[model samples]
Target chain A: MSILLNKDSRIIVQGFTGSAGSFHAGKCIEYGSQIVGGVTPGRGGTTHLDRPVFNTVEEAVKKTAANVSLIFVPAPAAADSVMEAGKAGISLIICITEGIPVLDMAKAKQFLKTHAPQARLIGPNCPGVITPDECKAGIMPGYIHKKGPIGLVSRSGTLTYEAVHQLSQKGLGQSTVVGIGGDPIPGSSFVDILDLFERDPQTEAIVMIGEIGGSAEEDAAAFYKARMKKPLFIFIAGKSAPPGRRMGHAGAIVEGSAGTHASKIEALKSAGATVIENLSEIGSTVARNFKPVVA
Target chain B: MKLLEYEGKEIFRSLKVPLPEFGGVIDKPAQINSILKRLKKGPWVLKAQVLAGGRGKAGGVKLAKTPAEARAFAKAMIGMKMATHQTHGQTLKVEQVLVEQGVKIEKEFYFSVAIDRKIGSPVVIASSQGGVEIETLAAEHPEQIIKKPLDPVFGLLPFAARALAFELGVPAGHIASFSQVATTLVKLFIDKDMSLLEVNPLVLTPKGFVALDAKIVTDDNALFRHTDFSKRVDIEASPAEREAKKHDISYVGLDGNIGCMVNGAGLAMGTMDTIALAGGSPANFLDVGGAANQERVERAFKIILKDPKVKTILVNIFGGIVRCDMIAEGILAVLKKMKLQVPLVVRLEGTNSEKGREILDRSGTRLITASSLWEAAQKSVAATGGKI
Candidate 1:
């Protein structure tokens, strides 16, 4: 079974009337995810894509029993959508919108801590998650995936896709792939996803793709070293990146000796992780390190 | 985006944080008279308005005893290129000089309010050891520095700021003002969506604690909320990089020869790493964004070609959900129109990628196609006369 999503997940899209929301929600529906209903503020009585629409998240939740909320709101109003979803008791919220003010996100996270502690938020600036063959909740390509054993988590969107393409080529599929996002303060952490992956019965091994930012990777290493028995193959981006240069839109910056690529690699290696130094070898290294899982 | 010292001080002044009296910002040597009229001073500090740190030790800052001295300093600094350790090796060109009245300091202390990534909140840091050597001080004596993590929702407490002020060894007379500066700065950090707000050598003069210098980096993601600073330019970017920004492309210039045009940021960084692994250096980091069409393709090529060091261009586009044939046709269409100068190596992956590969093969335009990253990187490196 996948950790956060599966066949039973009833998903609803926020900002459903908008182009981004409708497009991705349609893609998810195309991949067989249950697009139960949606919420788009002013257009309450109207219906789009053969789904009922509600003005508020509470009414949508009550009407459709949507357990998973996928947010595609714009940056300025995105955090409000997150808080509203949490307030409506959406257990799993996957936000696909990027560039929400960090302070807004941080405050929303704090609100969720007391308001709906049970809600697990995936990202506010990330490509969502997908449990291949069963459900595709995010914007990830549905074709490259096949039902298998690897549980993947990453901070990047297309980089996760790149890793999946490599794994798929090797005839190794995944249990669930979670994109935790690349924001300075994301909704979920590596440790949280790692905990879920460790407990999931379907996940045999895990692959984590971290980059030059934050202490998330190192924190994961420190927390999961001795406890995790499954083979963990990891790859970090930005080894060739210069210090003080931000590599991307998200929090991919190498600062001093703290969040450098080399330091992250060293930390993960010391924690008994099989670190893939070469980008092209992520799949091959995983194949060599673990007992093969047929696709 | 990083703010220059003068710009940061402008914010600090607006927030009512005590700062050294601003003489003037001089674009030319003749503008020193503006400082003399406003400051009415004999001694002034002439500082190059640059984003680099360690400017004091790098000769970017100097003390001017007279108007003639300030004019001379301004003349020498206005168009000067100066480098510090923070600049990584390249020099930053000084376009303006900030001439401020020099104040006598009883003591110096470091104060800053910045986002703490690990805690996922704002943190206030202070140290009695200040000045340009604060980095060295932190490296040598970590205990001298004190930190207080704050919740951005509730903001920093006055008592907490007082404690930080006290611990940083501010005298009793200046504690009130110091705490005021600390609180205001924290509020400014939250309100302005700043990533970092540093007041180096927040000096204690005879009257009170005065901010001798200021540095700020506003969050680019939150720039939409603040329209004034939205048009941010990376002071360290090369000409090609600045042009790429105007074209809405993410490109960072590097000291390499193989120009890399990749699909994603993470993949772009990874591509650069792989290129380095293949015994080839990447000329720049270019993420052509998710949807790469004819216009973006032409724009990306133009930016990459602007870099004279680029010997080969490696285009790695990973198609997700969107079919690659359309993107491939767009790339081919763009490629056909351009008077190409360098070897172009392309790798297209994802749905309908095989058809896209066929299109590239049939086009007969000079191109090298690879199915994998390794093959593409190696081919690109070989095109640049590198052996792997």
Candidate 2:
């Protein structure tokens, strides 16, 4: 009943022969994700994790009819791998590679618009999406997620896990969690995933985690103001972060009076979302908004 | 990485773009004589080589009508700390001054090629109003600027360049030179994997369109492709920053007493926010990243310890892609090798967290453990004598 992914969704692992790909794919499989096959150039005929492997994404898709492609390719070639997955007609592509050059991603985005407009690219430097207890397509720990009505979307990896852990501790399970990535230009945006959560019947409320950088949060706030149907809570990081210096993430920076924590919080507050000042208050804040749920 | 004005001009010259005649860099007043011998004539421009913008307003850029004036300017600029609005008042030491041939008065225009993330392609922006902030120009008179998006595949077409030149109101005689300069700038941007290439005040002298000033920023991720250019990185980064760069970790120093070690940038920042909320200021921001092996974790610990202001350390690991036990092992290894004077608080969650906790417990190090982020922040702040 979750959005984007469920127990029935078939998956294909890109760069499946690599250590990271094989390891995380095994974890996803253990969590009961329907991993149909894998793709690794030149190692096509081989079998990995008891599934068939193909030289190209097209071959993998043609043989196994895989709907989702999870990428673990290196940073330099990640953009091309995304393009390959899109060209092969995969409906959902999740890239887990980081440190990709911004220019390369720009070209890939252009290529996707013209070549594979239907394909929805999630992240090239993000922790992929997870529909708890149904399917897992990312590097997040599968044990902590619980199946429920709250849909979580964030721009960070571990921070999302922190929120999920808190929600679980509060007996508030989640329907789906998507990490939109922390790059200056991600393939998907907060509004894109919010639109999904808004339409999904299973998701009742949403938790959004954002950090300093870009105007994505402001854009999402504007969207929520106009078309929000559910209670959305937010927690932004990097309030005390120094300006002009990048705060870990490539996109987590305060540029010339823009992308400040105050500005982001003010934008979301004015847009009718409850912005939590502390990370520890997210669980209680969401709990207070909705009726008490029986654990 | 931001390149100095002189280094950016080197790339422009390498791409065959027209620029003011080369004048050597003068780091010392004595070097000014050698630079004058290499340059064309009496009148020259001495620009302080600093990374921040608005150097002209800061008096970093000066005109020297005589060699004695050039020597005086170089002496005053070198070893001086120059501040700019971009640097946020943090002064950058001026190590050298660029000496170039002065040009006659004609006209000034702004030209730059940069990645427009919204459009997912390289965008070339040109304005007849030059030597002013582009942001101000865009806000005040947007119609005065000509914005063109270049095709990533086919690149900047000849017709597109001609169109931009005509739209910028370039004289009919200088159209060819303007087009050449524009094309060359684009080529340099693409060839060197540059994120931004700006030629502010693209001067229109009697000769043609010569770049009066240049500023270039190359992509750090694409540095592997350009080994030579990677070696030219001279940002005067902090020592901790330099060490973190060597180990591929992200670290930013702060003026607090609590050092934070966390996995993932988003979580690292969240940890910092939580620490502040718990009534303690973080000494630095260190993200061990998603794959925190023992070596990287050890290096992160060393970098954090190098900051003498750190009074306590907080280690928060969610262990998603990175295993918690691996981080625990790194911590144990660092504790065994070095004398740690600061109190330590560790929080491990998800993916073999029990095993990681067991390792930390068995190590017998004088450290506090927490099962949640809230508890971790409270414990670290309390350990540092900050009320929670």
Best by TM-score: 1
Compared with the true structure, what per-residue lDDT tens digits does model 2 show for residues B180-209?
898888877887788889989998999999
lDDT tens digits, residue span A34-118, model 2? 9999999999999999999999999999999999999999998999999999999999999989888887888888889999998
Alpha-carbon shift of residue B256 in model 1 (angstroms): 1.2
Off by over 4 Å in 1: A292-295, B66-68, B132-134, B231-234, B386-388
Clashes of each: 0, 0
Interface RMSD of each: 1.2, 1.5
TM-score of every model?
0.96, 0.96
The local lDDT score (0 to 100) that residue A41 gets in candidate 2 is: 98
Steric clash pairs (candidate 2): none
lDDT of 1 by residue, A84-170 (tens): 999999999999888788888878888899899989999867878999999998888888887899999999888899899899888
Local lDDT at B46 for model 1: 91
